[model samples]
Target: MSDPAPDGLMPFQAMEILKRAKAMEATGRTVCHLELGEPGSPPAPKVIEAVTKALPQAQGYTNAKGLAELREGLSAYYSAQHGVSVDPDLILASMGSSAGFILAFHAAFRPGARIAITRPGYPAYVNTLLGLGFGVAEIPLTAANGWRLTGAEIAATHAASPFEGLLFASPANPTGATVDREGLRDIVDTCARLGVRLISDEIYHGLDYRGPSVSALELTRDAVVINSFSKYYCMTGWRIGWMVMPEDLIRRTEILQQNLFISAPTLSQIAATVALGERDYSEEQKAGYAANRGLLHDGLSTLGFALGEPSDGAFYAYAGIAKFSNDSLEFCERMLEEAGVAITPGIDFDRVGGQGYVRLSYAGKRESIELALERMAKALR
Candidate 1:
């Protein structure tokens, strides 16, 4: 008899580590959580107040494209923040960037079409594409180039084995490698030249430390851009985000959202609209993340972890663990069990080259990061 099985969708390892940490905390053990890309801050007071007022009036599902109010706010956001004009009609609110990705993938590509993504990237990009019956080609980014993805690499990879789409992020996950404006332009032009549809993940946009993040909208109108209130606004649990779709993909995406998600949470859409005007709160949070980034980077270096490139954005420090161990999974396990510190294994990001690396998130409080450093020094060093 043939075995009945589902597609092998790998678990997101950061969540696995967080689960272990929570379990330890449940048993009276103190744990320093450095896993997950989640910011440990609460949502802005304005967001909370807005949602509180919205709950009583909470209505039914919005149109599949989301509320006009939310979509209009997002349109104004791109114009104000990125200096690029986006039509309100081109915007769609999503149940976090996860739904946005699913809708974009289905609308942008046919079944079995190949897409290019970076290694040491968000694991969901590869996993989601695979689960949807699409092929993925990974472009490896290394420390020699500050872990940045370049136009040349895209061109070369396509020359060898062509892909129909490119899914990319700046201030990338796990690594925090952000591409500058010139670099981003090169990548956009290259994708245009190659006729590869680009899907830009800009969830971590405003969290950049080095400089401003460049949006694909500033360079081209063809790319599908995704952003979330979860990161910048400290609204992860809200599960709300928005997408800027190319003209060609708008109707297709709208139809997909109708069938697949119905719409982003009605309450979240309302709250997210308020979030767009509360950048002051988000900016204050960014300053705290900047400090945490320094603390984690310096502390990890002191422990002989080789940190390549400045973590110019986001809140993670992806450190090479070759100095301590070769197996990142086992290293993380030992760290959690013995040191009471929970971090994600690099294998979660890069399947082939991740064995010698680990990703530590610095999105928590200053005291927690200090405690983690102290514990690791005593336990490992």
Candidate 2:
């Protein structure tokens, strides 16, 4: 008999909104999609060209850790983008950040080990940990603190009750809070002192607006750094991402990758290799997101949606909807049905405080953001 499914796995609610929006679109109604965090652009031209050219020979299984060339390319990328030198040997390409997370969590912590993650952060982190049978400790971050986690917070929480590891995201999902270099350094130091392993999610690294996103590799080599080509490379459907592991965890992660995912999609990896070289194309995409962010932020604020913290990076705006409704799900549904604009309820990210909040993704084009704003404004009125 199959084992019972883990109770900790939660459905991705934003996908539900997308489904409803698709249903509306099927009925010939135009829906302004601000719900899912998907980029509006396709893979860079050069990336597609490379993949198309390589497709004939790209079908074979690769090294479980991924292709050597891709890993070297990613290593070069880290050096160029973050000024951090990473050894290509330590990099493992995975299906996406989702698979990378599974590998990292499995390699880092044994089942039942306690790991601390921020509340109002990425739901996948909590859900993945719980599904792996790891104990999750929520570290509450508030708007007063810009929704960013500080080293002091980690140290204080560890002092009261120790955990085996900490997982954090800069340019975090749902809430677009990015931690500065100094903050990251302090947190790294705190983790070292407290004997907690650090897993840094840098998937949104290239999508930053305020400033460059900090790499945990810049602070320490001991931390596991996960990144993806999904967001910045505009290749979500390509299903390719990677991780930079410490020397110690390399073999463990390699073994896990071998068993779980043989390697990321071969053609996607080829595309990603070319994508890594397209700095100009990536920057152009980032520019689009920046413009959309500004338009959405101002428009939502004018519509009386209270933003908790300024979204420093990423394409999401976590806004307070308490004035409209305490139930974020209901609020988002009303916005979708009445205004023809789909958004995500914040409850997907934070179970406790999220009922009063909703997350809107501005990862689409300028016209879409503008249209979504207009629709939402009308609905709110």
Candidate 3:
């Protein structure tokens, strides 16, 4: 056997597709990239200026929690943007939401504790929890219900097996389905009643095309909230994010951060502090994403792809491929090799129900979306 694939670890198929697409580009082929969810735009000019200014100073580590100035700014961000008052001390800077997930998983859950996540959810949530030795309970969602996670699902899942935590994302990846405020409140109330710790992944907060995203912090301080500058702020390479820790988990997460990370990158912390003030620039970027979304939606539908609900937020279009092929992976491979287009197989997000689906990211330029759709039409249509 070929090294008996690591137990409980599944490949992130999107990144795997990205790697292959890059190798093809190395051969001087011009591939239209829609596989990864990275912003086509660069960081705001003001953010760059701040980082350049900070570069001359010694970029040493901040304390485990991160720079006080940045945390204070994040506090103000919640107040002004979300209408919530979060204490600066409870906010811990992390190395992207990836690290924030790791920290939150470790600090919040006991060893071998079972955590519930939605099927058709972010792959990392399931993989990370499994890699860390936690039992994963995937609650299945469907297009019939608009791909929503609900209080009934949580309560029913908990009643059957009794998980210790529930981790979910509104404006979720692959689908870009957002839970509205009323729906969110019900889920929050259910989790509280069922004694399940909630972890909210709000990385796509500012990219909501429907309306503003509802922060879990607005409903409960007990939930562990995680966010990053990667998506809406277009700062992926910076590898910086933040977590609002539950009061009980603060000291543990801080101690874990001290040993696990020491601190987030000094330069990124400085950049993020300035990024919070660049909402106008972020909004302009969001408008571009909206146009790209419309382009992708209309193009894919014309090609007979059934996207359940139009993405309300985030920059992804999760489309059903039943009209094209039964195997999403094979379909994606053929698309890449023959059509010179790159997108992710839906099996990366939902192992069971995703074989007939694929996710195309609209986080790239309008030209890329147009090109990919054109190439796909010529090849498939």
Candidate 4:
């Protein structure tokens, strides 16, 4: 048998921190969770009601691409949210963005293809590429530049050696910095010029605290756009995500999804269709995230943690912890053990410049944020 795929994948540090925090809780310690990026709010009431109503219908497998209604709903959503028209036929739903990424990699790239990904990015991007026997060109980002990845950076990296694909995220994970229309157009143009396939991760689009998040779909029809109900919709456990692929790639992705996923959770697809129509529910959740973001920003700054840029969207504050410790892993471990506050080490996102950084997720309740801050202040002092 093949040796278990190369063991180069790093585990998500936030989940590991959660496990440790749970163990502490088991021992009667109260822990404030600031590690994972899950929303504190529950799924929309309409979503739950829809799921409950559909449960007795013996919901079965949907088309590999997704239910017609959900796909249409997603198309309508994009049209309303970004003012971009999308064809329902181009949408394919998978278990989550994770599975969508896998299907996309298989459909768009061949084994051994070199892909460009930004460091200080979601770890799963690199891990998944390596697992599929692909070469990765990691472009490093810095706090000085607000951690933005530009077309110039991509061009410089490609000049060093050719790469076939590029993966990018907006309102990015960990840092939460978002690019504007002009910047996005530059990257899209560069990718087209270089003949590189682009995969845009827009999972956190609706969770923006600053302004609207731009979708790659607005600028190019040549890219694969992946999104999920897991973040802004507060449905992480539902395991539903969708991808909008170029017209030519639709059939290929559908075949891959047919074999790999068969369908996204049927119940989730049904409920998500309803969830999309409940705009007020989603807006309320976004408001909570905005409040939590402010609390984390002021609280962390007061604790001397340096933030790179104002997190334009998403519910995280990736702060510099150099003033406390250069070893972020050790620092976080100590925080969990002594401060009763759990956070993720930056190494999981940025292997090179991460040792002095930490990612604090502010998706928890206001009381929890206040408590964590108080405990962190006392422990660090």
Point to the candidate with the largest TM-score: 3
Q: Give the alpha carbon lDDT tens digit for every residue of 1-381 in model 4.
A: 012234677777778889989999999999999999898888888889889989998368988998999999999998898899999999998898999999999999888899899989998898888888888999888777888889999999999989999999998998998888898999999999999999999999888776788999999999999999999888899999999999989999999998888889999899789888987888988888888888889989989999755598888999999789999889999999999999999998987888989999888788999999999999999
Locate the minimum summed-lDDT window of 10 residues in model 1: 1-10
Stretch of 10 with least lDDT, candidate 4: 1-10
Cα distance off (Å), candidate 2, residue 10: 2.1
How would you encode candidate 1's per-residue C-alpha lDDT over 269-330 as one tens digit per residue?
98998988999999999999998888888888898999865598988999999988999989
lDDT-sorted candidate list, best first: 3, 1, 4, 2
lDDT (tens digit, per residue) of candidate 3 on 6-32: 675788888888889889999999899
Q: What's the residue-level lDDT of 353 in candidate 3?
A: 89
Residue 204 of candidate 4: its Cα lDDT? 93
- The C-alpha TM-scores of every prediction are 0.97, 0.96, 0.98, 0.97
* Highest lDDT scorer: 3
Clashes of each: 0, 0, 0, 0
Model 4: pairs clashing at backbone N, Cα or C within 3 Å: none
Pairs that collide, model 1: none
Candidate 1 Cα misplacement greater than 4 A, ranges: 1-8
What is the TM-score ranking, best to worst? 3, 1, 4, 2
The root-mean-square deviation over C-alpha atoms between each candidate and the true structure, in angstroms, is: 2.4, 2.6, 1.5, 2.4
